[model samples]
Target chain A: MNLLPGFDDILAAAARIAPYASVTPVLRSAALDTLAGAELHFKCENLQRGGAFKFRGACNAVWSLDDGQAAHGVVTHSSGNHGNALALAAATRGIAAHVVVPEGAVRAKLAAIERAGAILHRCAPTQAAREATCAEVQRATGAELVHPYADTRVMAGQGTLALELLQQAPGLDALITPVGGGGLASGVAIAAHGIDPALDLFGAEPLGADDTAQSLARGTRVTTVVPDTICDGLRALVGERNLDALRTHRVEVITVSDTETIAAMQLLWSELKQVVEVSSATVLAAILKQPQRFAGRRVGVVLTGGNVDLQALPW
Target chain B: MNLLPGFDDILAAAARIAPYASVTPVLRSAALDTLAGAELHFKCENLQRGGAFKFRGACNAVWSLDDGQAAHGVVTHSSGNHGNALALAAATRGIAAHVVVPEGAVRAKLAAIERAGAILHRCAPTQAAREATCAEVQRATGAELVHPYADTRVMAGQGTLALELLQQAPGLDALITPVGGGGLASGVAIAAHGIDPALDLFGAEPLGADDTAQSLARGTRVTTVVPDTICDGLRALVGERNLDALRTHRVEVITVSDTETIAAMQLLWSELKQVVEVSSATVLAAILKQPQRFAGRRVGVVLTGGNVDLQALPW
Candidate 1:
């Protein structure tokens, strides 16, 4: 319940992940800026190690563990970027990584986790199944369970990206990131607000997966029915801590459709030649959908990841 | 003919285009390195302004002339990257751009050129018609001509990429690029030789558009009958002057099939999350086709462009 990381945690995470993570370039899109009548600066976290910003948190978490704790290694449940990031971070430290991946996940994602020397444990195709299997693996191997988003360390680690962005582009009118499980969005909101309380923070959630948007409106973490979103990475229900952060920070929740996300993904590829996954597309989608809110503003958006299954890109 | 520009010309061109052009990052692909058993240092000109490296030469050529030239603006014949790059560069320099594009060229490319504030002069489907009309436009308006290749300034400008690459990765054993009208290939050879005469320079052309490969074998320029390559940017025959440059440099010529080029493009996109057009895949195709020549050595590959027709990606 008291798991929210403070500003100090984020600062410490920045120091820990400094050596491993890339300081991705902040790019101004002439085309997108002109289209939206806004000055948009994109923080390209998609270009970071593991092709996603998740590596920042994962690397910090894996490296900060004690020698004995690291020897036993880390375990986590993720079907996407977080799995590959933790796997790679663990391998870099010569420690073990046990990823309890759900069945029916992309083969390429699984291959990436394995290639990074992470031991894969398949489970039933459900969040409950993934978490339960992850628990079992932790019990069997005495591995430290690395919660992808809920862990204070992981959240602190993710917040470091915002710290870098604020340092690089000070006084950006607003900061926006896509919300899936709200790990990155929560972390970004906290970091950006810490730097400047007046800085507006927003979460772009896919329309099909608008759990966060609904919860933000209801002023509580609300459970969702079965999800349906072309953007695979934004399918997670909002967490309690993330909901509190969203409520506390007054993070505006805007939703964009699958069509807009696909259009945005193609634009990045066509204009910037930056191949990003649909998850990253959500930020662009939200901006395009709510142009009035963002127009004529100096806004910063994080392209959170780039681990797209090319053959299976969301149409 | 004593028509070529000396080192000073290239330096001037670099200075001219520096303001308008992107200092595109040179990326290293570890997965690709392992596959070929060689370190692949990719000079990512694909991410250059206008989604192609042509911006360098085009910008240089368009901006090199005096105030009179700016008054008349510029004209060129291209079915793809050259047209778009020239148009965008001309727009950035606050000048008019006249593009003589052949019918049957990609509609998307034509739209991009138009969007960049270029006046479109569409002609018959033949390259000859396009060139003839471009000449007419040049003669009528007295507009400065920025030849796609085979111009002293353009070749020297393109050579700048090789200069940067060599400076970035001095230990490179070889430099490889796709040849289309021999502009990029010839410039790469010249720059590579200028950096180190021992550096092996090779042109990786499409088998269907293997005019350069055949011409080198014949000791003169030999045009291919009908270009059948899916590498659309490499369909043009090598310009006479560019051929001479290649021959003078004693550059080795290699050819790969469309299948290999597409595969290489997909590999680069999926593994590295870099969205490169098919033309940029030539170097990788050659290495995959003849791994023996490249294994156990350091290779520098110039990804010439990434202005792909996204709807028509040959994935």
Candidate 2:
């Protein structure tokens, strides 16, 4: 049986990635609080080293490698934030990073990943094609496959965000994170629950891609429907290990429609004065949708990322 | 002779406004540093209470009132950030704020001021009309007049930004702030020079509205030219007291074209991942324009505010 990462692993990851990953600030907006009927603490991972929480996971995975394995470098299949994060993390370690990006990935995102010094191997815009391309490149280059959300080390790295958040604003009644492949939410659940067993953990997802919510309801991972949301970063199927972690922790999953997500995004932009992608807006949408769930409580909302194409803004 | 505010006044203002204003974070960008060939520390007043550093001055001015004046409240003529700042500051002190806003002011900005709970007095879209309305409101209400950038207390309050910046990032070789009516720049000059006499101070301005630059060259305040710039927040002519402060500190004035300012705004949005108005981008434009003067040095750039119209994004 595969064992899930414990709080000890999160502590170790926090120490391991301290030099690379940013201890992002916990910001408060009074306007946001009034709207939600809750005191909200936002962990601004959008201001993280690679402009996302993915940098924490990527950095931990890159640095955790043994010397022999390190020399071989790291490889991943990501069209956006994760690709840029892994590339940046690898550059810090002075190791090669091979990112397999699909053909229809946003050009701005592709440029950012390339700028971080990743060798891009383009494939057709499909999961099978991306995986096939990544596997072939790994074989050709002898690079170690660092699965974006499934790997234990990446989950531990993502968990460090919770560690920092709790330290920044301790005694949070609950925590909310966007669930795509379930990496961030899974890690957050582990860390927050480990610190305070009674602390409620929630996963926010787009209604169009409610696989995680559906999986939690069905007691199994579901990967049939194609995502149809503007949150491009949340199009991946939930990994088996990630599902195991979420289920074991009893994480409550909630989904918000794209219309609600867009409205929440506008409110965030107007209220918080920050530029966040549509993916990061899901948690706020969830809070606004069910105010009773979070009202009068201190809720921690993890802003997953801020790598956006300015020219193609959704608003 | 109008004596410029000293370090002690800034200290007093800091102490007075501590409860109302925010000690905003100083952020850094590695990519931006590499591009500018300088280590840049951005004092993000855009994240401050009411979303601007104007709150510092307004808060200081509001609380400095004696019992009779406090009972009567305060009044100002502003169509943007200052109006919002004063309204919020007055609310904190449990007093009325009369903001004389000109007709045809940006709808979003006017809405923000109103939401902050200011009693908005509308007037013709002209400086004389605005001043006349403000005077009438003050006379009718027995309210104290707080000129946006001209008053000694306001200048001292604005100087608190420099005090915080210096404390946050010590040993800076230079500091840059956009020059509008000269409140922020004048205040920054006094605070920075007071801390380290050797530190360089620069005032950034748009080529279209280069009144401060012209005033510095002519050794007097210039107020005749029709201001024309995309920076709506920076069209005001330099105040006499602000000019005295700037002249006393020997501030170097630099001007960048509106085109260059827009490019810098884009770069800031892409690199910094924050929604800042065009007025706030001039400092970065100045840094990028004069590379040799600032290359390889530590520089502090004050992001003055982040109030922007989402529906009318310049890009």
Candidate 3:
């Protein structure tokens, strides 16, 4: 389960991706801060490449390969942001990319990946099927497999964001993000805690997809087949490596209802005029649902992504 | 029709409101640049106070009055951004702000103005009615009239943005914006052409409510009554003074459809992750629809505002 060797991986990723990724602004929400009784600093990863933070890892993973390995290409399976991100990173490096997307994935997302110059391959709905198909493609095409979160390189790359955040907005009382497979949350916890052990790490999860919450209580990594959350970006079950990181780091997991997430999303749009994806709303929803937990603290939340289909906004 | 005299007025206004308005970021959109076939630089006034560039003028006007006039306070007729801007500005300067808002204005906008501590003066849903009511409020309270446009101070204040834009991203091939009352567009044309005589200026108007287009073509000012357009912020006619400025400056006016505006807005949301109002989308719509004109050019567009009702995005 040791994905990263000390903090060296985080440092390496930071150096490698320095020229490519945007060091997005850490925005303070006066209205949200006043309402929540906490000073909320938003690390606006929604403004990241492919309109999501997924780009950081995707970019690093794509760029890390040696020229000989890169010539063979890279592959991943993602519903939206990751696919678009990998496609963009691959395009940036002039390398080939193969994305395994489930059938009936949002057409806009599929088109976006294609528009970014990725070769798309359709797979079955189930995770097992997706992994199998991705494996087959990787073997057949001789492309390097870059798992979205579970890979060491990807986790290392993702942790660089938290490193940047801590360096930029020091003394944050808490670091929070929406957790699906836990790559981002794990990164945040490691980076933030490594910088300062007092920094609290929290994961805002959809109540419908509360496997992480249940698994933490059960003291084991668990899987769920059917997740009924509108936050499509947060649909994955906690992987073994991420779940281990969560336990070792003692991450606090908060669950928010879909209704609350939509409410927070609507509020963000009205107040900030930034149309963030539902997953981004999860942090605000968690704070709104239980203000006492975050009240009067310097809270930092990663606006996970803005890759939601505008035509398909659930609200 | 000379409401504001040359660049002197804008310079003075800039000095007056120097401490209030935010020097918003000029963002570069790589994807949008490719789509428009131009080097696109966005003057992100969408991130300004009150979430629109209107705040600059409102803040200046509210703060520039003499001590006696400040005590008497300020009054204005606006449906949204202007009201909030004036209210916030007045509050900052320790003055009363009476806002005459037409009936059926977005509830969120009304709430925002109220939160900023403005006295609400609800009026009938018509420009004439709103103005009459605003006059009544002004007379009764002896409040200084702060017309949304058609005022010397406001125009000068609005011009400051263009001055900043020119300074920040100088040597633009052209400057474009969604023209409503023409306050912003007029100021931009003045600053852009003033700084660089060869800088081209263009105005984007909604086809459904294109009084500016007609006015420019006819060489006279025109007015519209409850004109229909998804760009709710661009329904105002080009005022007499602003029309004269546009004509004198030889600014090109282009009209775009609501469908095009929505598509442009969605494109920014998907690619740039910026939730701009429909009014701001006009510039993008214009550039996208007429790529031949913008291709290979260094173009600058004002992202005029970001205060759209996210709960009810027109898309």
Candidate 4:
């Protein structure tokens, strides 16, 4: 078997997740294009099932299990889109989902996960506590652990977005996605490159959470910095498999400041009329930061999610 | 010519505005459907040019003019979507657009209109002053006056949305739209009924500005109310032609409270991941308030616009 998730894995994942996930629409904004000096085709994953592209991976993982593995159900430690996506995906399969949510997680997000039938296991906000809680829950329930962005299956599922996006907007010169745990970026880089070798793949990172950029620059996974970005969805460190995929596929990770990300987020909201989270806006931020590189080209941007606090708007 | 816009007018408008206006997508949200106890197919006009369905009418009017009329350009006294839409439409035709904006109108909206290439003529915040200013601009520029909702051509253009929505979602049981100047509702009622005589059409109005409801009830246009609603777009009294169409088509206008409209707007933003203005939420508010009337049926809803002041969000 191939070490990295091959093109076939993404194709299979696309087929597996078809009945469960949404084939979200591709959106365009002339105003935004003028700002970046590039024609952008935004894959609106914010409109995906559970309001994020995370559903694709979660759906794939929940349905890919063998009969015995399925009977035990699935569990994950997450406090954002991945947890909610997994809960909803498990609900569709009528399987138990245990979400190990760290303390101080957004109450609205946790409520949404619970609403999707996930049994919440709370722990201290630290990563160690989250891992310990997830492990304990896994041991007690004999549940299959599905890491948010580390597993090959999950990465393959995330790559399905590129498959759909490439089909929707053919002849895209470059593809840009915000890197979180690097699952989406790695998956996109692998699948997009596999489909068209000439396509330039880019990963956007917040300066406050620039481990992915740091790792790529150092040629090693970096995980020492404490993230301090408004893009809550992209605060996770780059996963080992994700870093490997990025390196192998030659994906360039560009970093932008939180202020720039927020400005891009407002531009997307005001100009595109799209309700995307700050993390998703980072892709556009990266494009604007180096407009000369993408000028007059057809660029594809992945809008990762649209879950935001209504009362507390960043603008 | 017929007293009201005919089916052929809508068809012609559809073709006329196709190049300029978007055939806005029909979106669905299961959570919103469950809340209203009905399956709603939302015609997302909020995603239309100038961020509202008003663009369809404006584009049609601007393009429909003869050589002499087109040379003179188009003029309107709108402090909102119609003004911006007309400006953009005129820009497309390489003609001048003179917009008469009131003093107290939204600063962001005014800036957008200016950016769209409309020559702004500011007037007092009263009706007589606005009309006087509009007439003066029209006289000076020899521009054709396009009433926001009263003109037959404008109404015909707005009807094109219904034509598109019906084709997108075949066999709809009913259709609903928020009534402000009555242009959208009048056009929708005419087009929807022309397509399917049996289809029920409903209009939503905020109680604070229930002139349309009163007009439909008392069988005569009511134009003497001091409007007081958060839906700035829907505060205008029913127009003469709009009242005629609404009466002829037998459209029912349902009144909702500001509280209800706000709640529905929040629900739409949270569940549908759509950033629509409060005016657009009135349709869902009406459905939720009278679920029994629409339960277990497929309804087409027109989301009017997405232009709202982010700094002063109702939520």
- Return the candidate ranking by TM-score, descending: 2, 4, 1, 3
Q: Relative to the true structure, how large is the alpha-carbon lDDT of every model?
A: 0.84, 0.89, 0.84, 0.90
Residue by residue across A61-161, what tens digits does model 3's lDDT show?
98899999999999999967888889999998999999999987888778889999999999888778899999999899999988888877778778888
- Backbone clash count, each prediction separately: 0, 0, 0, 0
Number of the candidate with higher TM-score, 1 or 3: 1
The lDDT of model 3 is 0.84
* Clash pairs detected, candidate 4: none
What tens-digit string does per-residue lDDT give for candidate 4 at B212-305?
8888888888888889999999999888878888888889888999999999999888888888999999999999999998999999999999
Number of the candidate with higher TM-score, 1 or 4? 4
What is the DockQ ranking, best to worst?
2, 1, 4, 3
Clashes of 1: 0
DockQ of each: 0.71, 0.75, 0.68, 0.68
Candidate 1 lDDT over B59-132, as tens digits, reads 88877778876889999888688888889988887999999987787787788899999999989988689779
Give the CA lDDT, 0 to 100, for residue A138 in model 2.
Answer: 80
Docking class of 2: medium
A158-242 per-residue lDDT for model 1 (tens digits): 9999998888888799989998878788888888888899998889998888999888777767786467988777888877897
The TM-scores, one per candidate, come to: 0.95, 0.98, 0.94, 0.98
The complex in candidate 1 yields a DockQ of 0.71
